[model samples]
Target: MDHKQIPTEIDREVRIPFQGFYNTAHDNVFDMALEQINTDDSNDTVEVISMDNVEWTAVRLGYAQKYLAEIDKTLALNARFSRIIGQKDYAIGNDILLARVDCSKLVELHDAINADPARKAAWAYYVKEALTERPGFIPYFSAEVEDWGAFGTWDDAQIDCMLAFRGIELEIDETEIAMELMEYVDEKIWSSVIDPDQVPGHVNNKTETQLST
Candidate 1:
């Protein structure tokens, strides 16, 4: 599965559907994840095909804009994770993983560093020139804004589960990126049978990854 970029690519003018999100690593797990999460949503109507996360996110993100920015950035090249949850379960509230620096603020910081010509050259090299590309982690430069978030919907627990279930270690902090990774939870691991006594049990039980065909 292609991961370096999406099929539609990120467009400032065009809205990308849920399927357009890039899938670099776990292609097999994605379908299973989508099925599992859809079941969790309980859209039992036969007329309705599945949980519409694209629509869901669009609405949610729109409502969440007061807290969002025109652009947000994580200083690290890798996905950033923050707002740690210190609990025995450790799965709840994980959706609040987006600990990014607002790009406006980031720009100020960048400009501040660039004020010193010597520092600017060093910083430019560090940010732009010196960085090299490698396999599975090919580096790409972009002047384009990759994604805009209707941020602050899912908790970090929900956001991190994709990596957690697949043993993928990158912490996904972008709201849009995490939204695209809705399939992180393995269906066999998360239960379809809901017990009022244990929601966590439902989330982690060994169950079928897909409905019987």
Candidate 2:
């Protein structure tokens, strides 16, 4: 695990008591990359957007409680066990059940909310106080986990046992795993792809290893 701690201010009102995360994608973040990669019709070009091939980043549009509850009441995708990728233990967390989620329906719900000018304005009021991203709301739920800290991580098959006998819990970033995840996103997804020359040498090496395999 990397010993470096990600700097974050934990706003209890916005974060604690385990309020769920609201996922969104910014056009400022993704559309430019889409334009960059789709400039040519080569074989390596992405014809369509899918979670598997593209290194897409999801926005944490703060803990918009009312909106999140409304969205959850309409969840269409079932959460499934996700294969934990990457080598950073700090970013991935330990002894946690990572759920692979598809937020297509979630995005659809947002679209419905957005279509109504009055509802969209009302929804914006709830999240305006928090740090928010906008323009593109391509919501996604990928590899989010609830963590129990200092607890041993599957060394003696404890995680498997928990899965078999007792169901896992779903909460966001009990140990600030989300913080590390965002850091990882900034470093790996954005920096490496958007501006390769600016990424550290070590990050490029790690990216190479991940791609080659």
Candidate number of the best TM-score: 1
Q: Model 1: per-residue lDDT, tens digit, 1-213? A: 122222222211111111111232222234445455446346542311233212222222222221222112322322222221122332332112233333333333434544678654554444343224555455444211112112122223322221232121223334544444343323322333333243322233232221111
Which parts of model 2 have CA positions greater than 4 angstroms off? 1-74, 81-98, 132-213
Off by over 4 Å in 1: 1-20, 24-33, 39-107, 115-122, 126-213
Score candidate 1 by TM-score against the native: 0.24
lDDT of each: 0.30, 0.30
Residue 80 of model 1: what lDDT?
24
Report the lDDT of model 1 for residue 7. Answer: 22
What 10-residue stretch in candidate 2 is worst by lDDT?
Answer: 7-16
* Model 1: lDDT of residue 182: 46
Instruction: Flag clash pairs in model 1.
Output: 61-150, 94-155, 94-156, 94-157, 95-155, 95-156, 95-157, 96-155, 96-156, 162-184
Root-mean-square deviation per candidate: 17.2, 19.3
Q: List model 2 lDDT by residue over 1-213, tens digit each.
A: 221221122210111122222122222333444444444556455433222333332221211222233333333334333322222343343222233334333234434655788755654443342213446543221111122222122122322322221111222322343332333334334323433444334333222212100
TM-score of 2: 0.22
